[model samples]
Target: MTSSIGVAVIGAGMAGKAHAAAFRAASTVYSPVLPEIRLVAIGDVYAPLGQEAAKRFGFERHESDWKAIAAADDIDVVSVVVANSLHREIVEGLLAAGKHVLCEKPLSDTIEDARAMADAAREAEARGTVARIGFSYLRAPGIAFMRQLIDDGRIGDVFHFSAHYWTDYGCRPDVPISWRYQGPAGSGALGDVGSHLSYIAEHLCGGVQEVSGGRFHTSITERPKPIGQVVGHSRGNVSTEMSPVTNDDYATFNAKFERCVGSIEVSRVAAGHPNSLSIEVFGSKGAARWSQTNPSQVEVMLHDELGDLAGYRTVPLGPAHPHYAGGWAMDAPGVGIGQNDLFVHQARAFLEEVAGLPEAESLPRCKSFDDGVHNMEFLAAVAESAAQGGATVQVPANAAGTTNTVGTNTQEVAR
Candidate 1:
């Protein structure tokens, strides 16, 4: 049977390509498990890139603008891969056009904007639309295993957790500057990367009750231009003229979750690492840590009071795992999955929903827009705290009146 929901993908850059591939991969990925992915149209401001991406990814057509795609009669779902600053305009347009939307992380450039987008999404849901943030790590097989472990009571009464994501490429003066360097460009270490860990904490533990944080702006605020012409993906074009860099290069936040206390560190100038992200959760019964550097394996450590010894473990991703479907289980344990694999899995989940199955039945449980907003709000608080010299701030009291009182989460930034 033909799939019911047609997909429209906006943007054609790194993440756009990944999302499109994931939508295509979702078909073969599920096999006997999920629904088909109908590629209605791929949208990009650059027509050639859009056409090329469509031809490469099996999209039925290409459009020069998202507005055109959003108006398509066949396009039922839209994936917004535009810049953070463009999220509000594009997403609001899609929602008004009666399309479900999947947007990339941190929601928007500002907390208020994020809240508005989230409110729009929530409003759309009442009319039967779904809005999701592209926090793809939540779909990783290893991360799914952690979720399962926590559900099985294997982790037991989660006590504490910590996560960190770092990369050193931006620190190099030779690297060309992009929107990532501008605070108004919807770019920064906190929103760009910390949102990943923030979503994870909110999902696995609970809403953050509060946080104390410090965000650092680097000394090298601008750089020299390269000797080449550039294309577009910016407010104007991806120019190489020497421009200013205005976002945080490093950030650290201390927080208290509903049942756990933790810290999150995000950076684009960590020195030598590239795309390093890891999360460690310690509970009363056991503890586990997984890294994005190695997407296929999860290390676990079980408590042993009687044996008088404790050690970590190595668990392999398998078919039994959430995101690791069929052929992937055949790969060697040491082999890994790429960043796009998470999107592939995420698309598969959406396909399942489109086919009339429920989200609970899909793999890689997708995050709702509300969930995304909660994380964004916490991030805003962190940014605020960080700006105020890592001031200790309390999370807004939960609506359910469930407050967690934890005391070990004080950090002085060690300045």
Candidate 2:
């Protein structure tokens, strides 16, 4: 027998809609032992945006006040997908209301806010409520398969990793200085896409222990005020006046992990690269590479293979890989897997745990609030290193003074 779980998404932006669609699709793809998700409310600062999103995403109600989602008795799970600065308060409110929360990443704008949210989430966990941070890229078929290979020792002791996440959205001079470019929102490319790269690196390799060297670049000094509202990656026209860009446009850093050395390069203004995240991991016995640009396949090389034929081979992802089986047949060639499909996979994991199904205990999890704080700590170290002219900086062992570890069990290097 299945039940119904009331769901509310507070935000009407690109990520918020993705969360909404995921709630609608998770049941169809995974069929977890949970109630059908009822998308009960859509909330945004703008009533029209909320109303339109509710109508488009099949939510039963819409409101400008995000507080309504927490106050509503019908909502059991809430997705807080607002800007980085909004996460702490919104997540705290929903958690206080006893609602299971799935918040967007980077946790909060500042370490203090992130620590508070992590503490609140810990309190919520003690009461058996779920608190998950969205790292939707983890659900990608290729990435998940890569994780399985690493766990199966196919890659053998990972020693080095290199990752790049680039987008061209900030390249244009006429681009408006929205919240993404403001000081209160945090670092530009480093906090925006760099957070995702840091999470992915830690997700694939292990917790980053220190940033040995870091550098930041700001290509455009200033941007015009937006003439109208702008969604992510969308160009906003200038209004003649310009404001100084307060964030880094690009960043490069070398990191030391528990058992591996890694490099992370992130840019929001790289030409011709849109939403591209390419990663390569080298191990003692083998290596693997994957890219979000071509996400359906993973390329791998093994030293034990025929010497003449020892080269990277592209493997089309299928249900044979972890998490893929939930979306399609064993032989299915990455069916039901798309950019949007990732959120569905993410939501299934969250909802299955919410249902208290035994299998959820063993599944890959949505990152916890504790992990978010750890990510912020790692980012802080990189920023500190960059700010001090590429000086190395040691990262804190724990972000919130808790024993919580960053990354997944398989990704954590044995200490």
Candidate 3:
């Protein structure tokens, strides 16, 4: 049923121009219409930033070689926004050239190259082809309506989770080094933004079965060698030639989640936090909070019988939440949403699962490459619990079940 597909994007930098403007705004967002996507090609080993992100994302062509969009047989979908040590050789050569990939999180830069790119995305998903892991902040509609109010119990048995993902773009030490200050010790800022706060604290509480105090520091221990490339979080011209950051401009940890208990924090030298991700959950009856510096509201508190008039209220997100109705264009409540509309709802749920659709017409699929090798084995058990000083490690069970999609279908909410 591939009537038309072809998309492409291999790092035109800055989240590769938000996955090339989210595949040119994924079939103009939502509804059962995908297939003719074809913006096709923007690859970049820097050919003028892949010809200025293929003339600013309309993408008809520009490929200074990501193996020419992985040996183009008309690229049937690809994203892999480069460098986490080139995500296991450009996502195992674009899933052995069968395409359908998303990639761009801490899925590599080691955990043995994210378990060999999740075993080449399970042999390119047994030939039907599909790989994922952009974790576009879980396509935020206030974190998908706070994971649908903690899977419909409205945050009732969670028992505590906290988070932080601060950023100031490496708070000035002349922000330069690049390859994000050269990886390896929980690959800086805890594998860059604590790998989205360890998959949004295990996508709202579940499977992080252990980790502990784990800390890492770095605080600009050396950075100043750009003079060229260095795109996203741009400082772009440095060369007093310093380079010796080797990882962690602050990271914190503590998790154990088969049923909740987490705390995670991250920083890129956070001084005034130019990009903050905050979360809070604590249930038995209620508590919720969200914050990508307020990406369309969620604050909640609910513990019935408000005697002295309760607390934490905010809610705002409209079209009955969870990806806001028709996925927004003024889909109601307060009319504002950002982070590039969560990469256009993660490129319309990876082009509705590469256009095979029917998972009740898709929106919640995109998280697996065995959940990016279980988020690089929970960031290698928080860099092996900060190299043994903070102790308590455990984390490696990964039977690949953090539930990206199973039941309670979503993606049809225009009411």
The most accurate candidate by lDDT is 3
Cα RMSD, each candidate = 7.0, 3.8, 18.2
Candidate 1 per-residue lDDT, tens place, 319-411, comes to 555555453434445567777777876776665655656434445435666566666677778867877888987766433232111111111
Q: Report lDDT (Cα) of residue 330, candidate 1.
A: 48
Candidate 1 collision pairs: 209-395, 210-395
Steric collisions counted per model: 2, 1, 1
Candidates ranked by lDDT: 3, 2, 1
Please give the CA lDDT of all the candidate structures.
0.72, 0.80, 0.81
Q: What TM-score against the true fold does each predicted structure earn?
A: 0.85, 0.92, 0.34
Residue-level error in angstroms, candidate 2, position 242: 1.1
| Local error of candidate 1 at residue 117 (angstroms) | 1.9
Preferred candidate (TM-score higher): 1 or 3: 1
Candidate 1, position 319, lDDT: 56
lDDT of 2 by residue, 1-415 (tens): 2377899998888888999988987777643446778889998987777888999988998978878888998889999888888998899999998999999888889999999998999999998888988778877767767766777798899989999999988888877888788753226898988888887777677667789678888889898887877776577576888888887898899998765899989998998997899999999889999998888889999899998898999888875665565463233774435678788778877887786666424346677787788888889888888879889999877543322232233211111
Distance (Å) between predicted and true CA of 207, model 2? 1.7
Give the winner by TM-score: 2 or 3: 2
